[model samples]
Target: MGGDRDEGDSRMSNLTGLSDDLINAMNRHDLDGALRCYTEGAVYVSPVGVGEGRDEIASFLGAFLTAFPDVRWTPWSRVVVCGNVLITQWVITGTHHGPFSMPNGEIIEATGRCVNVRGCSLRTMDGDRIAVHCVFYDQLELYAQLGAELVLPRP
Candidate 1:
């Protein structure tokens, strides 16, 4: 039983390492590098939407990178690993000097705009690969800070 537990731990470590590598790749906008960390049938769910398979994930990231050329993520704390799951907290900082496409199909250029967003992710690993990932963040706060005019509900 001890040996089995050790093996599980080893697998968890490998998975956590893979997740770290993926984050690094994203910080660098290395699409290929990031894709390498995902399993062939990996799935990603973000506040924006869901992406199934590596190809879709690559496409989704590519579009975002194109809009935010200097996007970066700063890990705020060490990753917490458990079995095949890993949780990470991070802050993403980026400039919106280019055109951004909103989920409502509006594309607008935001010059000199900057955004600092706090986020967290839950990832499930298959061996050393990411099989599924779900990311959460405050989209409203991000947009508000980005200078979007807000309309509040009247009491």
Candidate 2:
């Protein structure tokens, strides 16, 4: 029983360590370093889009790097690790200095607005690498910070 508990703790520690490595990589804007934390066929899903593999994942994350060269993710609240999954609540702070693509396939030019948005993600680890990652955030909050107004269609 003690051995089993120890094993579980060890596994959680490893996953947390891997997650820290990923955050550090992102903070450094090291795309390759961040990619190393995932498996070749890892799937990343976010409000922005879904990336099925490393190349696609690169494009998905690279877009953020391009749009906010100074983007940084800081833990906004708690980080939970259970079994092989790690959940992180984080805050991203950056300036809109480059084009940002909207979910409607529209690209908004840089408005030079500073953005601080809260988000969360759950990453499932397969062995030491993340096999699946799901991210969540408020699109309206992000857009509002970029100075986009809500426009409703006429009924």
Candidate number with greatest lDDT: 2
lDDT of 1 by residue, 37-134 (tens): 98999999986678999999997788778778899988776564668788888998898877776666666576678889898889988877889989
Range of the 10 consecutive residues with the lowest summed lDDT in candidate 2: 75-84
lDDT of 2 by residue, 9-109 (tens): 88988888898899999999999999999999999998877899999999989998888989999975545466888898999999999888887778888
Task: List the candidate 2 regions with Cα displacement exceeding 4 Å.
Answer: 78-82
Q: Relative to the true structure, how large is the alpha-carbon lDDT of every model?
A: 0.83, 0.90
How many residue pairs clash per model?
A: 0, 0
Q: Return the lDDT, model 1, position 144.
A: 77
**TM-score per model over all chains:** 0.86, 0.94
Assess candidate 2 and give its lDDT: 0.90
Whole-model alpha-carbon lDDT for candidate 1: 0.83
